[model samples]
Target: MLGVAGVVVAGAAAIGHLGGSDSASPTVAPASAAPVDENGVPILSLPEPDPVEEPQDTAGKCRADRGDQKSGAGVIAAFNFAYYNQRNGEAARALATPTSTVQPGPELQRFIDAVPLGTNHCQKITALSDGVYLVDLSVMRPGQPVDRGTQTVTTAHLDGRWYVDAFT
Candidate 1:
């Protein structure tokens, strides 16, 4: 009876030693997200986007080679250049009758705003009188062909300089 009790105790001790110790160490933990609030909700928030502003001519103003001339074609070219480039101030000064009472106002803004970003080249210039001219312009816009027909613009010589008066 004593020998059997001794054998049982040795078997239990061998089993406990086999299961207790381990050769493998624990793996390192991976990085995790930010901590949560007391209510178990995440605290992270996304940033807002910036607003878009209107286009501006940071590189001074748009200029043309023959914009200051006193001829009908020159006046038309200068006006068109200024209009397309959104240089309203230059257009008002360089393309209008020097002595006329008309000022650059909402009407000019409406007219220029209607034209998309592009150039208008003068195709023909006919002198209707000593002080008036009929200018035919070929309007061109980006991603579009040259306009199919000519737009006639009437310019007048006043205050000893050429000025755009009307268009048809």
Candidate 2:
């Protein structure tokens, strides 16, 4: 598992340098404020910010929740779908950050290439930290026994989306 994580980090570094130094970062819209008239009257018809960043005493809100469990689950699901089910390396890579230092391009490609084509199912997902999750997975190939594994996946909230940063 640690070896695979290393490959992913290497792959990310590789992806980052693929286009040289000219790669442009994606733009994200800032959280918006409510509209008001010159006299401070509320314009109730306007759309409001989603308030995803509001502080909360409970476990659901804060900077920690910016890359929430739901997003982590989705990314892990998509990664599994692309890696095991569809065998689409490009799609799997898309779900990951391109600038990770631990997973460079060659290692990442090797990792992707080594993934066995099979059916993958998420058995359980546990949020271990704010932007990280522990995913229990079941993988089975035709005429083979089911294999179970657990991976700790880390994510980052960048450009308004959660990106897989590393996993082990």
Candidate 3:
């Protein structure tokens, strides 16, 4: 269940072959290209494929501070929906864990008033230990369309600081 080929040897021997097992069905090249020259051959201006570089996370510092699960889950995912959208129990008791039971009071203020607290941008990070982390909340609408549902937070160590012990 796999076939692939691209061995276009024109003057050494082989000629053409292409796919052979990968459920081949891809070739679609042709929109305006045909002309040869310059000690080479076929050339109509086909050169534009090299611009994909998005893989951050370079780990830069660590001398000894003891608390920064990405700055403590970016301060409890930036105040979880602004205190559950104004139900403001002093803004969810200032970022959860007053014996946290999140949605045990008023359906957590009607589930943070039915979706509408999006805009996370998700810079992606996932260190599960050594202080724990998993921030990815995907949902930035600066240009519209990104309202996924990928929230997560689980930091703890109350008293010395680390907050957010569960965001779901």
- RMSD of every candidate to native, in Å, equals 22.5, 23.6, 16.0
Estimated TM-score per prediction?
Answer: 0.44, 0.51, 0.23
Highest TM-score, which number? 2
Predicted structure with the largest lDDT when compared to the true one: 2
Model 1 agreement with the true structure over 72-110: per-residue lDDT tens digits: 666766776666555475455457665444446556677
List the candidate 2 regions with Cα displacement exceeding 4 Å: 1-70, 101-118
Each candidate structure's count of clashing pairs: 0, 12, 4
lDDT of 3 by residue, 6-32 (tens): 332221122112324353244444545
Output the worst ten-in-a-row residue range by lDDT, candidate 3.
58-67
Off by over 4 Å in 3: 1-79, 82-93, 96-127, 140-143, 147-154, 159-168
Total colliding residue pairs, candidate 1: 0
TM-score of 1: 0.44
Candidate rank order under lDDT = 2, 1, 3
Number of residue pairs clashing in candidate 3, backbone atoms closer than 3 angstroms, sequence gap of 3 or more or interchain: 4
RMSD of 2: 23.6
User: Which ranges of candidate 1 are over 4 A from the true structure?
Assistant: 1-65, 86-94, 98-104, 118-122
